[model samples]
Target: MTTNEPRPAMTMRQIREGLGHIEPGQPDPIVQTTGYTVSCLPEDHDERWTYTVRVSYRGDGLWSVQCRSQYVDADGKRSPGFCWSRGPQEPATQAEMDDFDAEQAEWLKAYRFDHVTALRIAKQLAPTLTYRGRTVADALAEPVA
Candidate 1:
């Protein structure tokens, strides 16, 4: 197939049918539909399919699903969605979270203000404003030289 050919659009039922075997975390009672619509390009032309995954969650909180796989096939075309096989679960560890936080903190350092510049800007913007119970000017007042 050429890389520019357009594939037929997939039906919603066909999309959900692929999700029958997926269960994320504990079996949640509510069912929600997550969809995927993708474009595929072949060596010359493209044939594509839109695959989707629907998940059920308990009817009272944030609805989410974690999966290992992320794609499905329809009409010989491929699309990405939730598609996970039950297997050895890789638990997200605290060290990973800590590393993420440390990276974020380092990234945020670029946005931290220089005391003198921040104080000057704050004074010009709102001389008497109290940002969080303390006056903005007082909070940013110059250090004794």
Candidate 2:
């Protein structure tokens, strides 16, 4: 910031809020890196990310919720929709390829929902999801493909 401030570049507050972590009394991870060039990619390889929730019912008639996420890279290349298992992939699981880091795919993992739970999430995220500075409903209302 100002010349009077310390040269470490990141305050404890900055580390917790900006980089999303706190390592008390340790060097800031971003400042400790070899190069202080970039922190996060602009749009994650120019990809448009999409999150989908699929609900299926078992024989018992309870809804079994699953999530599918697709990432389309800058070149308009898309990853398969599911790739969570270890080892060589079968044709069905081969649709996803964004597993380079576990944290990237972590958001899609925790969604076990019934009718009530699904409605709770929908109510919360309906206001949260935005496209081009508009709400999810507005985005859906647009005829843009």
Candidate 3:
């Protein structure tokens, strides 16, 4: 019978029954999207100045890591800021996955202990800020201390 009516959605019980039992500690068949950010103050900057390390999945077996600098003035005015993204990388091997984590950690460490160098590296990676006519990279390039 070909009817124009929409099919009813399957209930949870019916779906689970079709899939059978699942073992404990087993990875889920469905892919999960995950992300996190680590914020830290620059070695030489005051409380208003800080940076963040971001790691996120960009779908289709790809991941990305980014670092960004932020600032807020005493009047509570915020700057557009500048940022750099590393990759939408596809790690085909376990070693490559490990390298990804290591690289992100290294950048985090740089921001914590060597803010100037980290900003320099980020500037090199992303030369222009994609905001309004004003580019925050110039502000970031100026001496912090």
Candidate 4:
């Protein structure tokens, strides 16, 4: 398909289906859906999936956003990528939390990126925000332990 082709925006159901696989050390029983970003892996191999989302507690408490990434191999094995803070920088005040929540809702409502956008975010965030798949050449160059 041409790069310019418009793909349908991912539905809430689809997004929910691909999210927050509890990697050890990740908070559980309460990953807030919020919004997410995604990307496909390197070209020569079977397609792998990479996704990132902001999560927080569902109940009353301090509100903060933790950036979490999920990596799914071509065969669908789940692996942890990395996690970091997104906004409010933690120890958020009630006012900050309210503002962040409002801004986030607006941002999510206005933009739902397609594969192209996801790919861009993935490429840019690689080595920092998300897991990267090894390329064919790299695999061959390294000795298998």
Candidate number with the higher TM-score (1 or 4): 4
Worst 10 residues of 3 by lDDT: 73-82
Q: Over 4 Å off in model 4, which ranges?
A: 1-101, 107-111, 127-142
Candidate 1 lDDT, 7-122, residue by residue in tens: 89865555555676443343436865432222111222211111112222212221222111321121122223322232332214545335444534433232223333333332
- Give the per-residue lDDT digits (tens) of candidate 2, residues 1-145: 5587667677557767667576555564463211111111123332123323233432222232332343222222334433445543322232444443574344233322345554444333323444356544554454544
TM-score-based ranking: 2, 3, 4, 1
TM-score of each: 0.16, 0.26, 0.23, 0.22
- Clash pairs, model 3 backbone: none
Cα lDDT of candidate 2 equals 0.37
Q: What is the lDDT of candidate 1?
A: 0.31
lDDT of 1 at 79: 29
lDDT of 3 at 124: 41
Write down the TM-score for model 1: 0.16
The candidate with the higher TM-score, 2 or 3, is 2
Model 3 per-residue lDDT tens digits across residues 23-86: 4445557756465443333435432123444445434443344544332222223333322243
Which wins on lDDT, candidate 2 or candidate 4?
4
Which candidate ranks first by TM-score, i.e. highest?
A: 2
Please state the error at residue 130 of candidate 2 in Å.
0.3
Count of clashing pairs, candidate 4: 0
